[model samples]
Target: MQPQSLQLSGIRKGFGADDVLKEIDLSVRPGEFLSLVGMSGCGKSTLLRIMAGLETPDSGTVSIGSRDVTNVDPSDRDLAMVFQSYALYPHMSVRQNIATPLRMRNLSLGARLPLIGRMTAKASVLSKIDAAVNEAADVLQIGHLLDRKPAQLSGGQRQRVALARALVRSPAAFLMDEPLSNLDAKLRAHMREELSGLHRRLGATFIYVTHDQIEAMTMSDRIALMSSGRIEQLGTPDELYQQPATVTVARFIGTPSINLLPVEIDASGRVMALGRPLGVSVPARYAGPAMLGIRAEDLRPAAGGFAVKVLRSETYGADRYVTGHLADDQAVCIVMRQAAGDPIAVNGEGLSHLVFPEQRAHLFGADGNRIETTVPARIAI
Candidate 1:
């Protein structure tokens, strides 16, 4: 099947006075897996609903492969949506559930009745539907469960049935709204791998919505990080992790959450933290209060550097996470990652000196936007 591009422009939605989404514009490339991820009430789901034609935008255009679908019905838009709830019928067998969409689309109402409809429907059409259902079941590796009902299936099995239902359609694009949220952690992890592999096999356009950063990071070709009704950043996982566009993006995309330190940039653009030079400089126009962001993995122990009072440490098999507070300001805490057995140089007072290369740090202006910086030439030289 040829992949289709999905696009939305000037999307604005609100409930009462809330304004859930504001001027949202997004373009999903053909055969791309794009994830819309954010916290609860961030409007990622709403944006997805708009794309699927389940929720109409207040004033915007939704296009699919250069054709406007803004006013199209969900069924006629040729989009398949796999929801969080399996939504499978308890009374229907797995075969019936997976064949439901094709039946609705192909069979007339009179031809859908259990007994007489089977005879009225064309034998060739019925055979085609069965073949499609079986093919979808095989793709999802749920062929064995075809004879069962929803009630007899496990959480993972039910999810697979839901996916099979969606896959049977071979729609222009697939929109999934947290389809794996109900599974246990182990199963969720396993399904993540399966979903990624399935995308590679199908090569279809996909728009996925979820609040789990791990899911977005591991499965998506690119992630659109939404926050408070707007996209904080849209980029590859590495781009968001290595070079965040905003403080919110920096804070949301990382596992440990980037450590933010209160800082200031002087007239000379020198970055200062805890009244000490941080060995980095931003543009002179940003000479004022700022924030310095550093991921846990970036900080290293050094004999002479900024001091932090050790607070606590935890081991997780191969690595250790050490939590500490700035010696000068206990209100500011930081976490550092190191190999489990690596020794930390802690003095009698429970203080350790830590340092990070200037280029490894992120500087944000007082307005919470990222400020590009450079290692002072002398330091770089």
Candidate 2:
């Protein structure tokens, strides 16, 4: 299938008095993998449904390539939707299930009736449908399980069958709504890789919706991070991680969660945390109460830094996470990521000083918006 661009313009939706999607405008490139990701009730799924024609927006237009598809039926939109449920026919064999879409599209009403339908369909059409089904199954590596029923297959196998069902149609785009959520952790990880490979092979547009940032980060070419009916940030995985547009994006994108410290941007542009200069500076216009954002990996044990009383430490393979509360204020806690072999010296009082590099720090104003900063050449401490 030739990949096509998808666009949603001025989308707005509400449930009763609660607004779910508010003027969402997104454009997806042809053959690009875009993910709508966020926590529950963030409108990611609703937005995806609007694209699939499963749900209609209160206002807006959905277009495929250059054609408007806002009023088109789900089937007529030339898009295949794969749901989280793996909606397979429990009684149908994998071959029958995978062939269902092609058969429905290619056969007449009378030609769709089980055994009798087979007699009414053209020999060529039947053969074509069979070939398509077999090809899809092979692509999904499920050719060996073509004769098995959904009940006879594992979670991962059933998922492949579901994908095969969608693949057989050769749709312009695939809209997936957390299709791997039902799998175990290990299987989910493996499927992420498989999905990436499949996208490369097919070169078709894919719009994926998931609450898992890890999935979105690892698989998507670009991610639309939605929050409270708005896109908090839209960028590549690395862009979102290294330079989040808002404190919410910083908090949501990382595994350990980015460390947030209450800070003040003084009139001179120096960042102060607990009345001590953090050796960071931002625009003077941003002077006011602010927040300091730092990733765990950026914070390290340094000689003359803010003190944190060590509370806990955990090791994961080659990395170690040390969590502690600010010594000056117990309300503030910090987590630092370090190499497993790195030595951390804790005084008798179980205190360690953790400091972040000026260049790697992030500053967010009181309203949660990111504030651009400039790093000074010399340390103030």
Best by TM-score: 1
Per-residue lDDT of candidate 1, residues 273-341 (tens digit): 888788877778898999999999888899887899999999999989999999989899899998989
Give the Cα-based TM-score of candidate 2 against the true structure: 0.97
Can you write out model 2's per-residue Cα lDDT over 102-197, one digit (the tens) per residue?
Answer: 887889999999779868899999899999999998999999999998999999999999999998988989999999999999999999999999
What C-alpha lDDT values do all the predictions have? Answer: 0.92, 0.92
- Alpha-carbon error at 216 in model 2, in Å? 1.0
Please give the range of 10 consecutive residues that has the lowest summed lDDT in model 1.
Answer: 274-283
Candidate 1 regions off by >4 Å?
Answer: none
* Global Cα lDDT for candidate 2: 0.92
Pairs that collide, model 1: none
